[model samples]
Target: MSGTDRRYRHGLVLGKFYPPHAGHHHLVRSALARCERLTVLVCAASVESIPLADRVAWMREAHPEAEVVGAVDDHPVDLLDPAVWEAHMAVFRAAVPEAVDAVFTSESYGTELARRFGAAEVGVDPERTTYPVSGTAVRKDPVGSWTFLGPGVRAALTRRVVVLGAESTGTTTLSRALAAHYRTRGGIWSETGWVPEYGRTYSEERLAALRAVDPGADWTQVEFGSEEFPVIARRQDADEERAARDGSPVLFCDTDSFATTIWHERYLGAPSPEVAAVAARTARHLYLLTDHEGVPFEDDGLRDGPHLRPWMTGRFRAELERSGRRFLLVTGSPEERLRTAVAAVDGLLAEGWHFADPLPERR
Candidate 1:
């Protein structure tokens, strides 16, 4: 039967969706409109880094109307190889519990896939007329192709604006304000917010666990080592990434691993090479340095004494300068710091800043 004339009872579409984008959305939407029901199989290779379950979750969240399934298949993605295609087809069949009446896809292999499944082929936007972006292109330049991504995938490629400085320098306050501002309309980037500091949260959680086990445990006496910083650094990265997966276009970080590294040195006398390496590898779009001048220092159980704030702040500045990273020094009242941060973000927007791959290190 002809593609247009035949009605599909149950349609199937499968793809990696390495990071799902608008193009995938378009294909799914088109399939849903034509078929009575659609089953999207998010088949990921065993070798891919992104979690298959996470991708499946996004698909379900994105298209609640369709039935989404996640599966791990070690078969080759290349459909041109007969042996490989046969192996993949077997996995595809097993992934779907019931019979599929039609196969929906944008790739040229949809005809062969449908034939193998004993179903009709429904090609949607194979010529890329509707959505002209690919997963590979999105990976290479996510910031450039930001418009094509959904919130979850957008977070995967988000540019970070880290609000870093000494304790009580309005880092948390500024980060929350920045998030609120972005969530409101009429700005360069709206409906976006910031990621809270994971380091402090993790510490608080660990301390609470200790307290739970030992009621008389003193929070002030908590000790740390080089290993702790690396763990904190990794968790900090995880928190930022998880928040960004569904957060705004510009993710304002209350603090980053870079700050964690400084704290490591202050407390442990030396930062672990692992933590330092992680901080150096991940690049941020901009660093807004909050000066301690005229800011009140309130003691949180985790913070060092107010007297050491300036020294810590200086070390942060030194780290930024030594790394030759972009930074903006923000001082004055809370309102002033927010204004400066906003202006910096606005400037970035004006310049059409898109996150690109880090350049090769110089000799």
Candidate 2:
């Protein structure tokens, strides 16, 4: 039946949606167009890698036009046995509130599902012609399947790569290089190039504001206090999250909140709980530590001093080791550093690491 002629009062679309991608979005959107009220059942099993609640929330947010519900099926996927159908039918009946007039699906199993529901089966992109992507393909290589993800899903899957070290250690330079490289390879989904160091920009702008208000104030000796570190940490995290939401497959962060915590220890001679909390929350997948060796320290006005370079680098190393975060020490020319960092990320990809997977532990 034509879409305009056949409108269902109630439609049902059911799927595991391991990590909902563009195809699922297309299916749900198409279904919503034909039904006055649609119900999307996000079926999740215990053995699934992605959390059930998370999948339901994703579908709910993605399709606000429809009523989305989470359905948990602890039993194994035993499609061949007819006995399992009765149990499956019971689960569906309990999850869905009302009678479904139509069922929307892209799989062959839709025939049986519709039969059980006693509803008309409506197929969408059965051959995968319209949106040629699947959850299985996404789970294998999320970065490779960047085009098939929505902003919310993409943000969740964006792998944060932080380039950090003492001042004048080429952190900004390397961060940009890595971002450019990823963009060329179709990794970055955002137009902003990369997630730059928000702390640096924040400090500079604040210093300028202070100098403007009080011209006689010694802005050169601006003391680092607990008050500012927390602000910087939060800003840095927000910047990174914005990049992810904009569709960065591999987000290159100049410095993360973890680096902010280390800096807090350096400047205040103690730990800031706020900074530490932000650091723990915004942890990155990989870190490229820019070594201070052979790099001449230039006075950027913001830097503490040339003598503090070694101490800063040492502190960063100690913190990284203590936290047991995965890191690769990068040094030498800009080209060499970029090459090394890229290789390390490639190794991570080779391990079947997908951004949609659970965040890796500190290692």
Candidate 3:
């Protein structure tokens, strides 16, 4: 039948969708193509780490035309038992009470499930030849299946590492070096992502705007408004999100929205709660702070005096401590600092992704 053929009046696509992957999406799209109307039901168990609402949201974003619904199904799977089948159906029916003409799935139990629903069984990619991915594989090792995952899922699962410190303290250098180190491992690591400092871009733009009116104007002539800090923070966070979607499992950031709050204070001579709120939007996994000590401060026209370095470093340390964020102080030679940074990141990756085990199946 053609893709636009409405073979099924009302179709149903149901799955645990613990975390929506490309395979699940392909199944849903196939069902949509065959049916006039489609409903993608996402069932998540109580023990699952990823929230049901989040899965629903991801599905909605992925397939906006389809009606996406979520339900809490804590029942264990046992295709052999009729009693277990009934129990599972009770939860499923509660979420989707409307009549279903076709039930689409890749599971072996699709025949019985469609029989019970009085609907035709529409099998799709049962052998996993098309996408060749599953939620279990993603939960176990996201890096291995990074290419199979969509942008929203990648943004959520990506381990974000931010490198930040006072101006002229090698923040950009360390971030790029870290990304380069990861890329050497090859495979998925070769695609390791790095997000640049959006604040610098904003600074350059501001200086250019100043120079537009006065061609000889220097960086000192550039002025900042309290309202602009939040804009910069939001843009930095957005840039990180874009990189995480297409990059490897781990992503490196030169400076994040969180660091923008400190810069806001430095420029405006006071704290900015608005900028802090913007910073809170990102999930930064680790932070590497480059110590200004023993490092020559280059006046890049945008940098402040050397005396401000100690104060800025102290502020970052104190804020990180108060906020209870995990951070490493990069002191000593450049080589030693890279070693320390690599070790810290390695320790974090060593922990691996933790997914709560689902309820054991029973016969």
Candidate 4:
């Protein structure tokens, strides 16, 4: 078929494309071949890890003839703030073109997205598609599946791994151990460190702004309940792609959204809806929990007071279950925790999990 004749008239594919993989290739190729023109809306947050330019470059390389476009910024602010789902709908309606005929996705949210955008929703079946890969899977085990990623992507995945945890919970120790393990396994390990505790840095300033908006507002409530919790939660997601590129089989997060959930519950007395949603979005496997008693609780700048050993651990377990995420809870001494973590990684590898980086051979 002639290029013009075969192109999609108006079709769109929207995703983080942290590093677009063969599965993305399958969908885009199909869309390009079916529609007169295909517009790929690369999420702005995706740029944090794989730059928007690089993601677009990979897409162009894979489907050279397809018409691809980049969305300039993060999904509307309301989209990230889960309490305002309706507001997010309004933003989606305003931001996305009304003329697009179809929207393609492998996520459950695609249906709602199609309705909001006034487009037909096409589901991409990963198992039946050209490549069954997920960004989550790739971040967990990049080295083992380097063959599945593009050249530039493979290079990006090799530079950073972000380890996160609650205060005094052995995050630093585990991150170091994981780095050592990766090197021992003949892989390079790089640590970009944790997302800064934005709450501590900006809490007073944010509270001041809130008070300015509503002079009669309960400043204390807004401080802990409103601003502090959510800021830290949001920062957690900002680091995902960078950690993926740092190219380790597993990102080896010491504490993740689950820990954040416990923090909100314990400190704020109730979990912020925003933090809960962030937990859901960023929750993934390879979440390693250190034994509360074994890791000496110290009052680091971010971590203070005694570690909530029992309560937090239980909360972590519950949140993981509720979120339907698989996690490895490492108890006992430091040595025991390390042994357990290694076993968990091996188990995941044996299950045939592949990361999102598209192998050159597959391309």
Most TM-score-accurate candidate: 3
Better of 2 and 4 by TM-score: 2
How does model 3 fare in lDDT?
Answer: 0.89
Tens-digit lDDT string for candidate 3 (1-363): 654454998999999887889999999999998889999999889988998888999999999989999999887778788888999999889989999999999998899999999998989999999999998898888777778888888888888999999878888989999999999999988989999999998898888888899999998778899999999999998899999988888999999988988888888999899989888877789999989998898988876579899999999999998998889999888888889999999999888888897777654
Query: Model 2, which residues run further than 4 Å from truth?
Result: 1-4, 186-193, 354-363
lDDT of 1 by residue, 51-124 (tens): 78878988888999999998888754565678877887778878897888989999877888899888888888
1-363: candidate 4 lDDT, tens digit per residue: 854344446888887676676677777777776777777776545326456777777677667776656654543433334445565454444555558888777876778677767888877784644575766656666554465676557535433233344456675676667656755655343332233334444555665677798876543444355556666766655554455544444454444544566777877788778777776764355566554766777753333456456666677667667766666666777777677777776676566543333222110
The alpha-carbon deviation from the true structure for residue 342 of candidate 3, after best TM-score superposition, in angstroms, is: 1.5
Ranking by TM-score: 3, 2, 1, 4
Model 3 RMSD to the real structure?
Answer: 2.2
Error of 2 at 16 (Å): 0.9
Global local distance difference test of model 1:
0.81
Candidate 4 weakest lDDT stretch, 10 residues: 354-363
